[model samples]
Target: MRMKDPIPQFTDIITKASKLNLAYLHLLESRVMGAEDCEEGERLDFAYALWNGPLLVAGGYKPANAQRLVDTEYPEKDIVVMFGRHFISNPDLVYRIKEGIELGAYHRETFYTSSAVGYVDYPFSPKYLASEFV
Candidate 1:
């Protein structure tokens, strides 16, 4: 999966898109790549430098790390962190993150099964339901 400067082609696409005044650029990164859980960190500094506008990054980001990226890493730029698989496992994702509650685990096996098996079958945290936000 390794290649020498794999970004040239993508950067060229971004260069063309940048001239069109796009709203924002989306980037996907994760410590977990597909079925393998990797400890390697994500490096999107090139994307940050390429796109001067808003950037929406989605991956396996916990609340603290996401906040740090926005508030500290690129303080001067507009960066938004998005959650995908986590949201499927944590319905009250926002509330749980805000209250520092433990997040739920997802059933990867049932994911994308063409049914609601894992999509809408997960349980919610009782604490989140009892909280004032509910």
Candidate 2:
């Protein structure tokens, strides 16, 4: 089936899954700025129509926005909403989210360094960890 528009194609897939009662999640990477033109209500409406299961939105959710996302009410109250990418540099991302702590900024320069400069060098927040009994 050849189609010029991809929206119909996507809708077809979702419709098929719904008929089969298959559970699936949609991971959206459209940055916040890209979605800025649309109102929050519009965004939620499109998201609900696309996928009713877990929605993992990445690329632009900071701690502040993530909080709002989780608090927002949608058609599917049980739908799982999650944030990503903001935790790339934050090893203690879960802890920080729970405690409402600020996340460390990721350095793009070291992201592709040959050595372990940015990949595994990000230190965990001391506040989230207990002192070692050395």
Candidate 3:
């Protein structure tokens, strides 16, 4: 399922959505593309989809430099970071990040393990109001 250049007709996408002011770049399970070690801005913009590198490492948040695309001409284009796993576990992650709370490590055992052990056991940070009293 690999593609040499998966970006299909970028012109068509741009033209169709020309009236739209904002667009999101969804990189779905794109680790297979080996984009984990690149600089924040060295990735490709596949139509409206931007395939960037890894999300987090060890215990640090390595935010990609999406602002690099925002020059004087395209200053209106804002990049929104969409973390798949983090958002799935912590639905209120956007608020947590704003509050400067610690995000716990994910349970690797349940990544694809046919059980709910890791899936449900991963602890949320204290900032998570729903699971705070748990």
Give the TM-score (vs. native) of candidate 3: 0.47
* Alpha carbon deviation, residue 47, candidate 2 (Å): 3.0
**Ranking of models by lDDT:** 1, 2, 3
lDDT of 3 at 17: 55
The global C-alpha lDDT for each of the candidates, from Candidate 1 onward, is 0.82, 0.58, 0.44
- Candidate 2 residue pairs that clash: none
Q: Pick the candidate with the highest TM-score.
A: 1
Colliding residue pairs in candidate 3: none
* Ten contiguous residues minimizing lDDT sum, candidate 3: 53-62
Per-model tally of clashing residue pairs: 0, 0, 0
Which window of 10 residues has the lowest lDDT sum in candidate 2? 33-42
- Residues 1-134, model 2: lDDT tens digits: 22355556667776676666555555453443432422231143444566655555544566676556567545343344454444668888878877777888776666556977776778777787763421
Task: Compare candidates 2 and 3 on lDDT and give the better one.
Answer: 2
Model 1 Cα lDDT, one tens digit per residue, 62-114? 88888888999999999989978889999888888888887888877887688
Candidate 1 TM-score over all chains jointly: 0.88
TM-score of each: 0.88, 0.64, 0.47
Candidate 1 RMSD to the real structure: 1.8
